[model samples]
Structures are given as structure tokens and as C-alpha cells.
Target: MLPILDWGCAMYAAVDCLSETATVLLFDPNAMTDDGAAAWFVDAGSLAEWLETWLAGTGWYREDADEYEDVAEPTPWETAASRIAE
Candidate 1:
């Protein structure tokens, strides 16, 4: 899988995954506030629509993206690290 290195973009994708009932790990060197997360969630619908439009414009979907797969839950230390990184 292609690794996501952008913190803000990763956070957005993580939320998107959560909204769709999937799991994701969000980590950022720079901290994000609760308000920031809330604001993103507030605009998630519009953001998702725009993302889909942009991806479609770039023919990204034609690349045959795989379906979401279930992954093992993170360990306590991993969860703590993810939270700290965020």
C-alpha cells in the first residue's frame, strides 16, 4: 500500500474511514486540537464529495482500488503512540 505521509491529509482520510465504519491510525508531528477534528467532521460531507470529484477527475478510481480490508486492532502502546503523535 502507498504510505500516506501528510498529517492533515491523513487525518482527513482517517476520519473518512471512521465515517465509513472502518479503522485508521491518525498520527501527526504537529498536534491537532479537538476543535480542529470537530471542524473537519462538520465539513466531512462536502470534503468527501470534493475528494471524489477530484479523484474522478484524475482517473484515480480507474486504477482498480481494492475494497476495504479488516485489520488487527492496535495494541495499547500503538494506540498511545498514535494519540501522542497526533
Candidate 2:
């Protein structure tokens, strides 16, 4: 993952470099799961989409709430990271 933007509040915008389209993933470090692990959400398919939401006041950052809770996962990324390390 290549982080491209620092969208504060413990969130960051990164690009999945391993993906074919370099899909963007929004990382929310504080949004833990049942086991208390951080997860990533794909709210924006691209930089443009992410910017649109931010500008339009419809992003997860807005209202200080996770609006796309049902739109994401965890732990899968950890597996992928281990695989890549090998």
C-alpha cells in the first residue's frame, strides 16, 4: 500500500499498489473490530472519488462518524501483508 494523502483524525488515504487499478483504501486506525484490530475501508475507488466526498461533506470524516461502516474488513490485509513479505 502506498499512502498518498494524510487525511487526519487517525485516517489516511492510500492506494493499493498491488491492485490492478491501484484502488484507494481509507485506513481508520481507531475503528477497531471485535478483537480490537484496526481495519481499512474502500469508500473511495479513486482519488477523485475520495476528494469528491471530502468536498461535498459526505465523507466518513464528516460529522466525525464512520458513515461507511457496512462498506468494508480487517485482518485480511494482515494476511496479505504476510504473503507479500514472503
Candidate 3:
């Protein structure tokens, strides 16, 4: 399993196994601002592609945050991953 994306409050990731194609999962902690383990399988795709599609799609957008300016910033998890890769 490879850790792909972290939205600070949540995570979008994938797993690879010899037995199956890669599976993407979304681990959302604060679903609709309510407390619960709100996680689900997203889809099968590379992290980059998935992230790009998400950013391009309207379903992930929230009108209140000034058109998702927050999306431009890398999450703490992503920063750590970049450092580790370096």
C-alpha cells in the first residue's frame, strides 16, 4: 500500500497487491463536519490522476471557501512525503 494524498483532515490513498488492481480509498474523518469514521473506496487510478480529476470536478468543491483556494496548498502529509523522497 502506498500513501497517496492527505487533506489534513482526511486522506485519499491507494493500495497495490499481487492479487488485485490498485484500490483507492478515501478516509474522511469529519464528514459534513460531523464526528464519525466516514471513509469509503474512491476508485482505481494513480494518485496524480485521481487528484487532478477531483480538483477538476465540482463534487469536491465547496462554495464557502472562496472556490477551494485551500486546494492549492500541499497538506502536511504531502510535504513530509516530498521531504522523504528527497
Candidate 4:
């Protein structure tokens, strides 16, 4: 995966080189385990979408953004990550 954006605290928005259609959002590694665990989530469907969300000022990362409440949380991408890593 190639990281395109960093949200501090070890979080990032990355492009999956394998699928290329999906964007991976990573949380702080502190929540990760030692047993091949991950803090990755399948967030935006594409970089364009993520950028759109940012431009609209409704990013889920925002403290005051309504998207945080209205939008469903990104799903875990551990399976996809493992598959892609291979």
C-alpha cells in the first residue's frame, strides 16, 4: 500500500496497490496486537472520494463533522491487507 495522507497519531490514508480501487485508513498502531493484527480499515472507495470528503469539510476524522455520526464507520481491512501483502 502507498500512503497518500497522514492524520497524525500514526493514522494514515493509503491506496491499496493490489485493488487500486480501495483506500485503506489506518488507525494508531497502539491498538494493534502482536499476533499479525492490524489497525487498517477500508475507508474510502477511492482517493477521489476521500478528497471529496475532505473538500466538503465532512471528514469523519473531524471532531465536529456530522459524518462522524451519520456515516457508518470504516470496516476492518485486516483480511484484505493480509491478502494483498502476499
lDDT of 3 by residue, 1-86 (tens): 46666657555454433214344445544442232223334443445555565676633434554566533322222222233244
Candidate with the greatest TM-score versus the true structure? 4
What is the TM-score of each predicted model, taking all chains together? 0.21, 0.51, 0.36, 0.74
> Which stretches of model 3 miss by more than 4 angstroms?
16-19, 31-38, 43-86
Off by over 4 Å in 1: 1-12, 17-31, 34-43, 46-50, 56-86
lDDT of 4 by residue, 1-86 (tens): 78887888777777776675666565556657664346667777777787788788676677776635676467777575566456
lDDT on C-alpha atoms for all candidate structures: 0.33, 0.61, 0.43, 0.69
Model 4 scores a TM of 0.74
Off by over 4 Å in 2: 34-38, 47-86
Model 1 CA lDDT for position 85: 45
RMSD of each: 12.9, 5.3, 11.3, 2.6
lDDT digits (tens) for residues 36-68 of candidate 2: 334666656666666666677765555645656
lDDT of 1 by residue, 1-86 (tens): 11232435443333334334323333432444553332222211334453454455432223343342422222222233343346
For model 2, state the Cα shift of residue 8 in Å. 0.9
Candidate 2 to truth, TM: 0.51
**Highest lDDT against the true fold, candidate:** 4
Clashing pairs in 4: none
